[model samples]
Target chain A: MPIPSPTVITAATLDLRGRPVFVRSTGTTDGPALILLHGLPTSSWLWRRCLPDLAEALPGWRIIAPDLPGYGRSAPRPGAGPRHLGGWLHALLTTLGVDRFALVGHDLGGLVALTDAVARTGRLGGTPHPARTGGPQLERLLLLNTTIYPAPLLVLGLLPSIVPPFADLSLVWLGRGGAARDDDRRKGYVVGMRQLLAPGTVVEAVEWAEYARPYGPIAGWREARRSLRALAWQAPFVLRCLAHLGDLTLPTRLIWSRHDPFFPLAVAERLRRAIPGAEPMIHIIEGAAHFPQEDQPAEVARLIAEFLREPR
Target chain B: MPTHTPVRYVLTSHVEEHGGRPAAATHAEIFEQVALADSFGFDALWLAEHHFGAQAGMVSQPLLVALAAATRTRRINVGTSLIVLPLHHPLMLAEQLSTLNLLTEGRLSIGFGSGSAPFEFAGFDAPFDGERRHPRFREALEVIERAWTGEPFSHEGTNFQIGEVRLVPRPTRPLREFAWLGAMSEQTAAMAGEFGYGLQLPRGQSADHYAAPIGAFRAALRDTWGPDAPERLAIARCVYVGTDDETAIAEAGPSIRRFYEHSKGYDKTKPTPAAPELIERLHFIVGGPEKCAREIAAFVAATGISHLSIQPIWEGLEHGQAIASLRRFGAEVMPRAEALIGAERAAGVAGQD
Candidate 1:
């Protein structure tokens, strides 16, 4: 007997604090909620596989994957960096009526989730914010292949600080090139994205197209450039949030791909040690690169489910 | 026109001792047999889960064995003849099976049973009382099904209290599509039907003994899921095919007797009646191709089973002999049996028309 494919995924745009936030969601809305945040250059579409499977695995729970502001279908908040994005996420969740839920983030999204978690802990600069009082409570936090401490070699971290104009020009070139005329350039961009996955992992052409779709337009490149530039300014605040990670009391699990070139396993190790009660919470998935969700979605899903199901 | 329900032949194994060989050797032979079965176009290969006594069976985790078998052969669906559900946590089981499903690219089937062995439950430190066991099994099944839905669910049951949690990686497909309920009682068979799962009849039982459960299962299935609901009833039987009846008996008779003797020895409470004729009639299907085919057709005709899960290898049987038996069964017995079944069904349809 063959297993049936997952439920139909519903995509919608929500007006969060007057910004059009594009979201892809599945499962029942009334169940316990799980929100998925995708990393840089990718949209909620990063969780195309994870959403349906996670929703199916966790019936009754609402599984929401949102294109973070400035990425995918969401309109870019011109000056919003990681900190601002984190605040925006809280507002988005609050607007969606998700009072309490688990959060999973990858890459830049991980930084955002961590920022949100730190802010919620009332440990950000040792001062409690108003949002901490009545905001959506994070039941659990799962980070994948993301970094907290700034590394000069960090692609997202380095792009804005070192070569902002060059990065901007490259994005424009990659975005503006027509599909038929610049097939090689589009293929090169897809190949670059494929490099983020484990070597030899066969990603279908159509899937690559979905990943590249957002970046096909000038708006996508403009949003990507803005996010990159904003990260350079958000560095100090993100580091400060990182300093207060020890104060976080919520359950945290770190899943890192062993061969991630940008953020190595050492980054996960550091975060694991910094967070309270997270000593035994780190899992290293082998045979995967930066995008473990794409390289090994099953393992990623298993780890997430296992960690979430663990008694709080 | 009435359509014929084609009987699917699946090879099953307990991974039992073969001539005092090591457990590793037995596992290797099972994989080899699995490859052979796959090559011969068997519908699936099911492995039984057992614990404690090494001589009784080596397989404690049928899913792991199934995974190994799945990797070794392509196209053949691998399954647990029955995983002892009450002993393991349902969430963990769901996760592992889901991983197996993904790894195998969805060539996986599962048979779940509330195991009968008291010692097996004792080893796992689980409750063995029928009163507790039955409910726990039922609750676990409920949890597993809910987990497969990839939806967040909370369960506060008699045996388990699960907080809001969902199964990860979600199953490639709904696990129920490939799930079977291994029923030892008419009540369980009815429950399998009520749940809309396939029903797997146990081995070493008479056709008369199985009739009630089969009837209950089909009736419940029709009543609950409508008449169009698939009657995926599978029966496990000891089957061996040879060039002639004399050759078949000479090769398989002693091993067949020893198999029953070992089974009786394990329980001690059950009668150790290993009369060759009675065993031949009820348990073993050892004969030449023609005879094996005829018996298989008759059994299918009588029981109305959609699948036949055959144990071609037994304790003390040579691995080569088992392979040869499987070869003959695949090349001769299977096609002949299928032809006979088709003819019988066609005749029945003609009579109706």
Candidate 2:
């Protein structure tokens, strides 16, 4: 039987190396800081819509939603690609004095956030940056709308040097015109994001306006391209660090949006083979796309909150 | 962009009283007046700062003025005409501006300046090296911007070292307002142009003095920087409008004198006393709606100025008269001015076709 979890929601922005990174926190700040990294073209704003519900179920954890570079209010990275990307994430958390966290990645943010966690693992062990070692040491890994393929097999292409304008005209074409759409199915999206052992019962709306608010003028298409291109440099680190996935022995959850355009569900079994002892928690949402937060938000939040509450 | 609801008048205010008006009293008065400006249909209001005065009540603080302006008005965009940058760290300014932006829910503009007055920098230990001020001002701006986005940063340069300083409580929107550099000289104006920031030209400079800077700004924006460069360019000019020419002249004359007198710190050459016609012709905006509108249009065309900040309330003008004048500007002047600039922008966009 699925266990029930509580949900919470809050909105805020944090500074990341002189950049304004907008964040949406779900759950309590006391239990653990779950830095939920958002995927391509979307921002921490995506979590906002479901934050209130997710917050309630995860009573003691703080859920953070930060607008990664070149998305929402966060400007482009001062330097390009994975090296600076990992450093910036480390800098962002370090600036906040958050020592340890349970790293969760969705789509692009998942890959980047995970890579940074692994790169800074030494720093998290009292090496160079002393303050980084004290808190939660990447206790668990939650990957939603993600692709962990090692090389040329990755689906999405990377961020380009010269991106075409009007890249986002498709989202508008897709009919997400700031008005709430498809009210009925959101419950499932919420259930997935909760990390409790038993999924919490939640209303369809997850702080509706908060998550939608940060998507200014739709730079997601451009951000997706950039984030994917970023993987070229980031993938090696990911492959290397993720190589240590079996060694850590932490519970790894893969909440896959089955209809995701980028990551094929057929790869799930392959993923299990790649990371030994992966302990995969497969969540296949029927009608969701690459961005489960936008496509199936409530369920994603519910699954995350429920997963976090489970006994290891 | 929201619909422009016929803004006819423009007003500019500053804590000009040199000895720094008692913060509490000034705060109450500014807010009270600004709220009234919103209700009364004023288009825009600007607040500027000058530091350290023996008696003239120098209101050296820019962030404080922005805060007061935020609480005082809604609908009207409040701006800092020039926040003397060298006097304060840019990171602190960024945080203050971001907080003020949140308070206003996004109606804040940060106007930056490299302190010109030797006395103003004396207290802060900043040298009066005019040559160094421009570079220092640019670097300081970078530091501030860096702090706005994230954790502590270390920037090593010839003059300043920004080390491990983080700016918390960032604004809801990052770099929303147009960041303008107050350019009293061509060099500084060119620097602002190079950086793709807006330019706030001084009130008294002629079209020729402005031509080089404005030209530099446009060339840099179009050729050097991309088209997405800061789209707003504005200059400061003294403006007062009323019914017939005489009525307008009657309201503005004495106030113009005081404004000019106060501005003497920057322009040491005393303004020569002139006849009424000369004052109306060159220095002030006076007369009926048609006459004022024509002057504004001509000024925009002559300078290719996309925006202008006008001072409607003077030191001696009655508050009632000022409000009435603001109403006139909002209803009459703004339409004409916007149309003129709009046409210019449209034509420019058309030429792109």
Q: Residues A127-232, candidate 1: write the lDDT tens digits.
A: 5654777867788999998877765324564564234222334645555545453455445457567657787677888888877776555556567667776777
Residue B75 miss distance in model 2 (angstroms) = 2.9
Q: What is the C-alpha DockQ of each candidate?
A: 0.01, 0.02
Candidate 2 residue A101 Cα shift, in angstroms, is 18
- Best prediction by TM-score: 1
**How high is the DockQ of candidate 2?**
0.02
The Cα error of candidate 2 at residue B19, in Å, is 14
Highest-scoring model, DockQ: 2
Candidate 1 residues B58-161, lDDT tens each? 89888988999998998999998889999999999989988988999989878999998898898999999999999899889878866775656666767899
Sequence-dependent TM-score of model 2: 0.50
Candidate 2 structure quality by residue, lDDT tens digits, A140-252: 77777665566322434432322222233343335464435333112212333332112332424545333333333334334445555666755655666666544444566
